[model samples]
Every structure is written in C-alpha cells, then in structure tokens.
Target: MDDSLIIYVVASMVTVMAISCWRRRCQKSLAPVPSGYGKVFKSHLFGKPTIVSTDPEVSKFILQSVSEDFVPFFPGSLTELVGKSSILVINGSLQRRVHGLIGSFFKSPILKAHITADMQRDLQEIMASWRDDQIVYIQEEAKYMVFQIMVKTLIGLGPGEHLQFLRHQYQKFVAGIISIPVKIPGTRFYRSLQAKKRMMKLVKYIIQEKKKNNTGCISRDIIDAFLNDGSGQLTDDLILDNVIDLMIPAEDSVPVLITLAIKYLSDCPLVLQKLKEENTKLKHKSLEGEDLQWMDYMSLSFTQNVISETLRMGNIIPAVMRKAIKDVEVKDHFIPEGWCVLPYFRSVHLDKEIYDDAYKFNPWRWKDKDTAASSFTPFGGGQRLCPGIDLSRLIASIFLHHLVTGFTWVAEEDHMVNFPTVRMQRNMPIKVKRKNIDILLS
Candidate 1:
C-alpha cells in the first residue's frame, strides 16, 4: 500500500474513534433538568430512558407503593459486583427470606452490645493515635474505624492482618461498584471484580470456619446467627453476597456521615458548642469510668440532630434506583415497564421548599422537625429501609460523643464532592488537640 494511503486510513480511523468516545461520554453525562420540565423529567442512563424525580411524594410512591410495580434496579457494575443473590440486587421471596434470617440479627440487643464495645474500643484507639497539632484525614480514619466495627461485630473477625487485607480489598471493591462496566485491563470495573473475588473468598472462609465451630444455636454475631438458624434458607453464596453488600454500604455511608459531622461541627461553632454541652453533661452523669449504654446514645438529642443534619447535607445515598415491573403512572408521569426510575433523595434534601437555608449546615432545623419523615431518607424507605439504621445511628453517635467530649479539632480544609457517594475532596483533613482536664471537668 502507498504510504500516503496508509496515513489517510490511520487518520480516518482515529477520527472515528474520537467521535465514538465523545458520544460515549455524552451518553453518561446527566445534566440537570431544565426548568419547566416539571418535577419529574425523562433522561437516559447508559442508553436506557429513565425517569428521575426530585419530589418527595413521587419518591414515596416509588419506594412504598404496594402495587408490585417497581423493584430495585442497581447499575450494571453494581449488579455484577454485588452478585445475583445479594439482598441489594434481589427482590420478592428471596429478599423476604434473607431479610427474615438477618434482619433480626441486626436488630438484636446482643448485636448492639457487640457493636457498642467494638466502637468504643476502636474509636478510643483511633483518637489516641492523634496528637495536638497533628493533621489527620477524618474520612480515611473513619472508614478504617467503621470497617473494623462491621467486621468484628458482624462476622466475628478480630483485628489482624487478615482483617486489614479484607478492608483494603473492600475499599477497592466499593470504588469500582459504580464505575463504567468495561472489564478491560486497568479499568475500575476490572479491579472491582478482582476485589470482589478476594472479598468473597475471605467471607467464605469466615463462614466455613463458623460452621465448623457451630453449636447449632444462634449467637451474637451475624455469621453464627445465620448458621444456627439451621433453616437452610440461605445458601453459602447468598450469605456471602449479602455480607459483602451490607459491609460495603456500612463502611462507606456511616463514615461519610461521621466525616461530614466533623466538617459541619467545625464550620458551625455554635452548633458544636451545643453538641459539646449535651455530650459533656452526659459524660458527667456517667459513673467514673463507666461505659455508655444504648440509652445514653438514644438520649443525645442535639448529637442526633447533628447526625440528621449531616445526613441531609451529606446525602450519602443520593438516589435509589427502581425499575418498573409494569406500566406505572406517578404524579401523571408515564413510566414504561423496564425503564429505570430514580428517586433523587438528595434533591428532596436540598429542596428549598422542604428545607430553609438548605445549603447551610444547621442542626437546629431538625429540633422542631420530624427526622423520621420521608423527606429524610439517607437510610432509604419502605420494606427496603436499611436494616442497619439503628446500628448506623448508634455508631455515629458513639463516635460523635467520644469526639466532641474528648477532643478539640479544627477543619484544615472542608470541601465535599458527591458522585458515587458523598466524600471530601481532601478526605476532610483536620488538626486535632486533646481537651485539657479543666475543659472535661467543666
């Protein structure tokens, strides 16, 4: 072939490839809906037409309506990574059975006891490592702390090289859960797939070990609870998938909330003062060296408000996806069967009509409002309401209680970005100082 002809051919191919890539990028872009499109607007996600809603009433209909018209619909990357048997991806009878087997475990008093002990010890250890004037990334440290609590309390796995390894792999897995679904070398999806395999192996080993030592009676830990139930309702694969699903979200969402709480408290000193006062008074009420009880956490009205406000602003779960099982009309918007429906909780959380000064960090706004209302759904709603809601709150509250009462911190940088999940751009670095005895005694 002539050299000129070859060069022309290469140029043409390059141009074609460039256009293809640009179109792919545009296909993934989700620009804000223009005004006059109503509360619900149609958009395309990965080439499929989807309905996106920012209305709380529409969100309620999609999440709670009992017509069997909609079911959970995760992205392709998540569906592949979480596995078919995962409770997050499955629906109908299996979901109920899986929920039945594990739901009680999450709500059990024994489980709460385990989490309390684990969280206190872990938080103390983490805080002890911080020194006055030292800079620490709260998001990174919070992830480590939350992951440790979940592993130890849920799977009965103690701190070790194995636990650390799983945490590392799980982090990578989560990073890839929402990436583009290509499996080519060096792609996030490919790495996530590898991480998923490693995590599954670790979880399977833990499950087998528990089964070997089972006494056929329910135990405080989730693994033993499933094994001892002996109903055989959950196969090993199902158990492993659900465990991964639960751990991935627990590791990310709670830590994001914790880190955001730190940011908000630092940004709003008056709110911090109120939070500190509430927590400090509780600390004074405790008998010397006595650990806090679950009731103690429950009574933290201001601290709980801080968490609610952080959840609202943080928007850890920006949206929940569901696919219509049949043709459904929500608020006069037609949604065809098989089309994706996204109830954007973040939109509702930030809606000016729903929240005053919606962008500002204000815990006081929650004082007079019902925090459990549908407008706030960081834990989601309906039958899929997070089984770990109470536990998540407990974890955040314990961490906040210890943090506000035990230390003083100033945010070095406070900027957050939310795409796959809400996270700090700088991982929320902060300078730390231990409170003096006089401050604690006061």
Candidate 2:
C-alpha cells in the first residue's frame, strides 16, 4: 500500500470515530434524569440549554449569593447590538452606578408622578378605540397601549395628531432593536438602523428646539430629568441610548405582563369582581399625582395575589443567561470557565417541591397573610435581578387597578388562551366586557 493512501485511510477512520462519539453523546443527553422532580435533564436539540440545576439552594447561590462570578449571557445578536456599556451588558461597580441611575428614575413617587396621567390617558384612548364588547387581539392592543405609555411619559407627546405620528416611528425604531449583524437590504438590522436614525433625528430636534427657545418646559419626569440637564452628563447621545435601553423593553414588558394578567384574571370572576369594586372606588378620586396612591389600600389582598400569580404562571424572562466567570461545580457536573449559565426561572417557579400545585393557576398563593414575601418572584431574584421591578410593579398596579375596576373579561370562543411554558408567553385572547359605572358600586 502506498504511504499517502495509508494516511488518507487513517484520517477517514479518525473522522468516523469522532462522529460516532458525538452521536453517542447526543443520545445520552436525551435520556431522562432521576424521576418525579423537576425536569432538570439535558437535551442537545435546543443546544442543551435546560437547567440541570432546579434546586433552590443552587438557585440562591447563582441568583443571589455569587453574582460576582457571573455576567449576563446576552443573545449573541443582542451583544453585537447593545454593545457593552449600556446597563444590560456591563458588570461590577459600573453596573451598580448605571443601575442606580435607572433605579433613581424608577423610584415610586417619581414614576407615579411621571406616568399616572399618561397611563390613565393611554388606557382611555385604548378603551375608546375598542368597539363595545369586542374580542380584539389583546396582545396586539396591549402592545400598542404600552407603546403609547412609553412615549407619553418618556417624551412629552401630549394628546394630538403629532403624538400619533411620533409613536409610529418610535414603534418602528423599537422593532429594529432585535436586528443585528448583516445590515443588508430586507434585513432586520438595516431596517433597525434606519429606524434608530429617524427616532434620534425626531427626538433630538424636539430637544434642540426646546433648548433653543428655553421654553421653560421641564418634562417633570425622566425625559424631564434627561432634558433639564440637556447635553450635560445626560448628553443627547446618552439620552438617546437610554431611550433605547428604557423604552424598547418598557414597551414590550407592559403588554406581556398585561396579557398574562388578563389571561389569568379573566378566569376568576370573584377576583375580577373584587378588582372592579376596588376600581369603582377610584372614580371618586382624582386620577392625577398623589390621588393615584389611593390604590395602596384598595383590595390589597386580591391585587397582590393577582399580580403574584400572573408572574408565577407566566414566563417573561424564562431562563436568565450569565457567562460563568470561573469554573463551577454542582454535584459531579463541572462547568468550566467561559461556559454560559442559565438560571431557568420557569423550572424553579413551577418546581413541584417548591410550589405545591405547580400546575394550578392560583393567586392566593402569594397573599402575605403574615409578613415575609414568600417564594414568589416574577421580577427575578438576587443581586442582578431586574432593576425595573418597582416601576414594573407600579405599571402593573396602574393597569390592573383600572382593569379590575373598569371592565370585566371572558374567554373568546375558539380563540381561547392556552399556556405552554416553553417560551415566555401563552398566546391567549379574552373578551373584555366593559362595565357600567352604576352596577360596580353595589
């Protein structure tokens, strides 16, 4: 046999052997884990991304105790898009300072003062557009209303025709955010860039005009804080980046949480009724500034329960991703340095051992009958948990307070809502039965 032929044959066998080993490894991953606990098993189909660690102790360590050793595992596309300085991409003290800034903006009195009027206005506009007793796509409507809320508060877009035009472009800009790399024609990335440019142009022009005139126009909110110091530490460029950071995600999360709340709340008529009564009480109070705080004591039990239950059942940020800072061990499994970590929230939220009736949709589970805020955490847990939890809670409270008070909900036939925990949502629709103010009182 010739030497070259022998070498080729040897190489071919090595390739075949390697392929065999890979196939065997894939098959092993498909096998199930120890029975009757969480499905803390592995499968390579979705890149073997399932959480093999559902233990709360383990979760506590990763989510709370040891955040120093991990940083976010942003989607490769997002990493390329958001860069590394924005709050979502950084680590250590820089993360703290930046998040502190975000936290300051989201603080209770500030956000309530900022968004209450806009929130009420946006809700009214959304409701007015709906035909009486219509079964619209709540998901789409919710998305639109949230977008309006984001704009009305983040900018000073008041009720007018111009507000609508600006909102459309803002929507276009947000839609482009998930676009990354290969910015060619017909691509999401290229389209997003165009959207970004248009948005900055419009917003910058507004800011510049305000600066030029010294219109004595303070936003009285975030956009206000950002604008008052116009071109200081909060430069136009930084404000625009912050716009992307806050508005895009803010726009998306509201609709999602609202949709989930509707799906969950529609089923429990008593819960709905309680909310309605609570809401009815609001009609007597002013809908602005400090008056919104009246919601603090109204149906406190039921409100808290509904919010908690919705969060638990829904999977918004299903599996949070973090890059391991160093080698870590759980049991016998060794995840080496640079490997990604996903503290899968869904698995933990529904773990049979943790939640008694893991599949049952129950809000009473979260009622603080005594004191401690139980095992319920939809806003995430630990040091790096979502900074917007308070603001999100406030937004949710604003929407739900009105929803429970202002309207009633029923399932739409054939277009019924369903839950599947794989992704962060359950695509569902409900027929909102608008309430007459008289009947809710008695």
- Predicted model with the maximum lDDT: 1
lDDT of 1 at 265: 88
Per-candidate clashes, comma-separated: 0, 2
TM-score of 1: 0.89
The CA root-mean-square deviation of candidate 1, after full C-alpha superposition on the true structure, stands at 6.8
lDDT of 1 by residue, 1-442 (tens): 4323533565456446534543454344333322234566665554456777787888888888543888888767789999999888778877877777677887887778778877887788889888899998988888888888888766888899999899889888887876667787677778889998998898899898877888876675777776776666778898888888888756888888898899888889899999999998888866377777776887799888898899898888888888888988766667787888889898899999999999998988988999889888888888788888788888899988888888888789568887445789899998888988676885
Could you tell me which 10 consecutive residues in candidate 1 have the lowest summed lDDT?
26-35
Name model 2 segments beyond 4 Å from true.
1-52, 65-68, 128-131, 159-166, 173-180, 206-219, 223-236, 277-291, 294-299, 329-333, 368-375, 414-433
Worst 10 residues of 2 by lDDT: 415-424
TM-score of each: 0.89, 0.76
Q: Write the per-residue lDDT of candidate 2 for residues 377-416, one digit (tens) a residue.
A: 4566666667776566666777777766666666664232
lDDT of 1 at 432: 82
Residue 139, model 1, lDDT? 88
Off by over 4 Å in 1: 1-37
Q: What are the lDDT figures for the candidates, one per model? A: 0.80, 0.59
